[model samples]
Target chain A: MEILIYLTQQFINGIQLGAVYALIALGYTMVYGVLRMINFAHGDIFMLGAFISYYGITKFNLPFPILILSTSLLTAVIAILIEKIAYKPLRNAPKISLLITAVGVSLFLEYTLSLNAFFTPNYIGFPRPFEIRSYDIGMFSINNIHLIIFSVTIISLALLYLLIYKSKYGIAMRAASHDLEITRLMGIRTDNIISFTFGIGGALAGIGGLLYSMAYPQINVFMGIMPGIKSFIAAVLGGIGIIHGAVLGGFIIGISEVFVSAFLSSTYRDGVIFIILFIFLLFRPNGIFGKNIEKV
Target chain B: MRFFLELRKLIFLALFIYLIIKLVIFSGLPTDYMIQITLYSFIIVLSSLGLNVIYGFTGQFSLGHAAFYGIGAYTSAYLSKVLEIESYYGLIPVIFLAGIFTAFIAYIIGGPILRLKDDFLAIATLGFGILVRVILDNSDRISEVLGGSRGFVGINKITNLELSFFITVFFIIITKNLIDSRFGLFWRAIKNDELAASSIGVNTFIAKLIAFIYGCFLAGIAGGLYAHLYTFLHPSNFDILKSIDFLIIVIIGGMGSISGTIIAGLFWVFFIEGLRIILPSEILEYRWVLIPIILILIMMIRPYGLMVKKEGY
Candidate 1:
């Protein structure tokens, strides 16, 4: 009975962890779906979101609700600006050049933030805004933070689903992803759609960052690197261009990570994640939902 | 015409050797910081050229060269320390074996990994690099000699200015010859268009695999040399950032240009070390703020690199 409870608790923890990854993975998949490029800087953007929100709450003393809206909106604008300034000119360049530029942008964001006066190079404790409370049901226990994470993830995902399916803008995004040139020929402004896609992706990453801080309650310059890589892996595992696949892949990774740490040595946690990525790349390069396009 | 070109090349080689011998005499005997810097630059040239072959000529993106570098370092360190191999002369053979072992490992993994195209391949290799770091960090469970996070210490410092300089020159000549050969044409073709190359009856995968292995072999040799020179092995030295450093050297040197790689490697090492003298103590940590900007500017202004005009044989 005790073992079952422990297993159930770990499962819940995994779900909570997976929810954050899924949020970040959504941004990754959405951007790749439209641009066919990995925004290597996305994770650092997520870190910026959390840091901004942290400052707002602690320094400016903003409410939690206000913090979420402002952080998401701010991050969306920043993401659009990044696309315009850093990635726009490289659109016609070779794919490798674009990839290198993305890496450059990622490094720029990371090291720039680490410079003194921007943010300290040290880890800062994230003061929890709310009272700590736990609710126990039968043999398992859950926290208020866990509840918030679940509620926010489900609501955001539902809104994303509606935005992608029920809205005209979403339809335009889908069209743009399918064929940018054709969509432009059909009178839809592709540049706007591309920027909008980046905005949405950035907003989702911001939310992911906020939730992550709430759960872990700590922030650092490098907090985004591992999660960003893992979420990208999640994005790949689910099939890079597929939205739902990203979510599935994120949960699978989160759960597997928890299990590995719980059953095996915690030292193997990172190695296992990397190994999964390697195996997937070897056997199924296109991922679970991605279609393989053979070139002539 | 060919005879005159060969004579010119022979003269250039003679001048190069004379210059190196002069430098080695002035700085090599003293073994001071300047000599140490030059020796380290040679090691960088070897590794950067290795990366140049894989990414530049073969057009296969590998973000994991540092992993092979670490593998070579650890392997050599292990052979010298744990196996307790005697004889100073034996160290040369041990270094060769370590490099070969790293190449063999690269060859094995290259088959499956080379199948992925472009960005996918980049991420896969990046993952493999991280995996190597993690394994190196936690390898103490398997053996105590690895020293885990503390790093392996007390290895012999067998790499000196003379030895490293000669070895570096020998490898550069070998690579130069390889790139000038008929097989080099196939690599160039594959880089230009893999599909077209395959249609022309070239085994694209096998050719790429050979380039990858050879490049990794050079990196392994560099790593072995580095381990002995520092007489220490740390897992952190071979992380993703180190891999990026090698990539930057190749890119700055202009891909596929041997002379460019050499020049850029020397410039990069001296420039970075020079920063120590130029930058203030408080801003030392912030010195890297300019690197990414420089990289971006380079990509924007000269995507083909500084020596792009001399790319082909």
Candidate 2:
């Protein structure tokens, strides 16, 4: 009975972690779907989201709804600007050039934020938006923070599904992802669609960042790197361009990480994640839902 | 007679070496610091050259070059300490052995990883890099001398200006000769288009594997030199950021250009170290900000790199 309760508690913890990863993974997948390029800076945007929230709470002391809206909007705008300034000129360049530029932008964000005036290179304790309260359910207990994470993830996922499936912009986004040049020839304004993709992706990462800091309660400039790479792996594991695959990959990664840290030594946690990635890459490079496209 | 036939090229190389020795060693310009920078520049040149082979010539994007470097450093450091080598002469053989060991490890991992393409290959190599770092962080559990996160110290300082200079020049010559060989042709073909190269019966996989192994071997040699030069090894020194630094060197130098690699490697080292002398301690962190901005701007302005023509190789 004790073991069962422990397992359930770990399971809930995994789900909460998975929720944040899924949010980040969605951004990665959507960007890859349209651009076919990994937005390495996406993770830094998530970090920025966390910082913005931290400042919003400590500096402005804004209401919860206003804080969330402003953080998402600010991140979305910054992402669009990044796409315009850094990525737009190199649209026709080689893929490697794009990758390098993304890495550069990522570094730029990290270091610029690390400046003494902005935020020192040290880790800062994240301010919680609300008080935490735990409620007992039979033999197990659950926290309100967990409930917040679950509800937020579900709401975001449902809204994203609606935005992608039911909206005209979503249809255009799908069309853009299918073939950018062809969709452009059909007068779809691919630039806007691409910008929109980055915006939505950045906004999602922002929300994920906010929720992640709430769970972990520590924010640092380099915090985004690990989760970013892990979420990217999640996106790749679920099939690079697939939406649902990212969610599935995120949950699997989150659960496996939790279980490994719980059972094995915590030092092996990162090693095990990469090992899982290697196994998956070896057996199913295209991911579970991905179609094998032979490049001629 | 064959040497006579190459008299002009040989004379130019000797003159270049003489100039470097004169400018750095006997010019009365603070021998210790100058020699240190010169030796470090050679180390960077060798490692960047290795990356140039993989990414520049063979078109393989590896984000794990530093892992091989770290492996070589740790392996050689451990071997030397364990064997209790007293003299620098004894360290020479250990360095080569370290390079060979790194190549062996590369050969093992390259077989499976080389099968992956583009971004998949990048991620796989990155995974390996991170895995190596994690193991290195816990390496104290394996042995007492192989310090974990705290760092590895007390290694012999065997690397000198003469040794580093000679080894660097030798490897540079070897790299140049290799680039002019049949294998170099195979690498170029594979880089241009693997499918086309394979369709022409070029054995693209074997060619890529060779490039990957050789590149890693060079990285190992550089790492060995680095271990003796600094006499200290830290896990953070071999992280993803260091790998990216190599990538930046290769890209800025122009892929597949040996002279460019050498020049850019020296420039990169001097530029960063020069900043130490020029900038105030309070604002030193801004260099990181400036570097990335320059990188992004360079990509925008000259995507093919500074050395390569717009038409590209």
Candidate 3:
């Protein structure tokens, strides 16, 4: 019974972690769907989101809902600007060039934020918006933060699904991903669609950043790198351009990471996750849901 | 007749050697700092040159070059410490052995990873790089002297200006010769188009594997030199940022141009170190901020690279 409770607790913890990964992975997948390029800066955007919310709370003393909304919007705008300045010029260049530029953008965000005037390089304790409370149900204990994270993720995913599947902009986005030139010829502004994709992706990562910091209660300039890379792996694992795949990949990665750290030594946690990626890639190079396209 | 015809080339080579010897060994520089920087520049050039072979020539994008470098450093450091080799002559063979060992490891990992294309290849190599770092972080569990995270100290600083200079020059010449050979043709073909290269019986996979291994071998050699140069080894020294630094050097230097690699390698080292001297300590961190902006601007202005023409060298 004790073992069962412990396992259940760990599973719940995994799901909470998975929720954050899914949020971040959404940004990577959505951007890749349209741009066909990995936005390496997305992770840094997530970090920015965390820092923004930190200031929003500590400085402005805004309530939770407004704080979340403002941070997400601001991050989305920053991301759109980033796409315009850093990415748009290189649209016709080689894919490798785009990748390098993305890396440059990432470094720019990280170091610029690291300046002492901005957020110092040192780790800062994240300010929680509300008091934490825990409840027990049948040998399981759950915290308020966990519940909030779960509800927020579900609500956001539902809204995202509606935005992508039902809205006209979403239709244009799908069209753009399918064939950008054709979509452009059909009178849809492909550039705006691409920018919108980056915006929405940035907003999701912002929410992810908030939830992640709340869970861990620590914020640092370099915090986004690990989670960002892991979420990217999640996006890849689910199939680079697939939406559902990102969510599935997130759960798998999050659960596996949690379980490994819990059962094995925590030191092997990162190593095991990478090993899983390697072995999985060896078997299914395109990822679980990724379709193989032949290059002529 | 052949000697007479190549007399100018021989003379230029002699002059180059003389310049390096003078700059590295005999120069009464303001400090040992200048000499160290020169030697470090050679090490960076050698490693970045290796990256030029993989990404520049063969068109494989690896984000894990530093992992192989760390491997070489750790391997050499451990071997030398265990053997108690105090002399520079004794360390030379160990350095080669380290490079060979790194190549052997690359050969093992390259078989599966080289099969991946573009972004997938990048991520896989990145995964391998991170995995290596994790292993290094916990290496002391395997052996305390390995010094997992605190850092591997007590290393002998035997890498002199002359040793680094000669090794770098030798490898540059060797790399040049390799580029001029038939394998260079294979590498160029593979880089241009793998499908077409394979159609023409280029054995693209084997060619890529060879480039990957050889590139990693160079990185290993550079790492061995680096271990002895600083007399310390830390996991952070071989992290992803260091790998990106090599990438930046390769891109700025022009992917396939050897001379460009050398010039850009020197420029990159000097640029950062020069910034340290120019910028006040209070604003030293701004250099990192400035560098990325320059990188983005460079990519925007000259996507193919600063030194290379559109048709490639």
Could you say which candidate leads in DockQ? 3
Model 1 Cα lDDT, one tens digit per residue, A203-249:
98998889999999999988998899999999999988788999999
lDDT of 2 by residue, A1-296 (tens): 99999999989999999888999999999988898888889999999999999999999998877888889899999999999999999999877788889999999999888888889899999989999999999999999999999998899899999999999999999998888899999999999999999999899899899999999999999999989989989988898878999999998889888988888888888899999888888888878678863320
Q: Tell me the lDDT of model 3 at A97.
A: 86
Chain A TM-score of candidate 3 vs. true chain A: 0.97
Task: Quote model 2's TM-score.
Answer: 0.96
* Alpha-carbon shift of residue A7 in model 1 (angstroms): 1.3
**Mind giving the per-residue lDDT tens digits that candidate 3 earns over B159-224?**
987688778877887887788789999999898888899999998999999999999999999999
- RMSD, every candidate, angstroms: 2.3, 1.9, 1.9
Better of 1 and 3 by DockQ: 3
Q: Docking quality tier of candidate 3?
A: medium
Please give, for residues A100-169, the per-residue lDDT of candidate 3 as tens digits.
9999999999998889988889999998998999999879999999999999899989999999999999
Question: In model 2, how large is the Cα lDDT of residue B298?
Answer: 80
Model 3: DockQ score? 0.68
Error of 1 at A263 (Å): 1.4
In Å, residue B22's CA in model 3 sits off its true spot by 3.4
Ordering by lDDT: 3, 2, 1
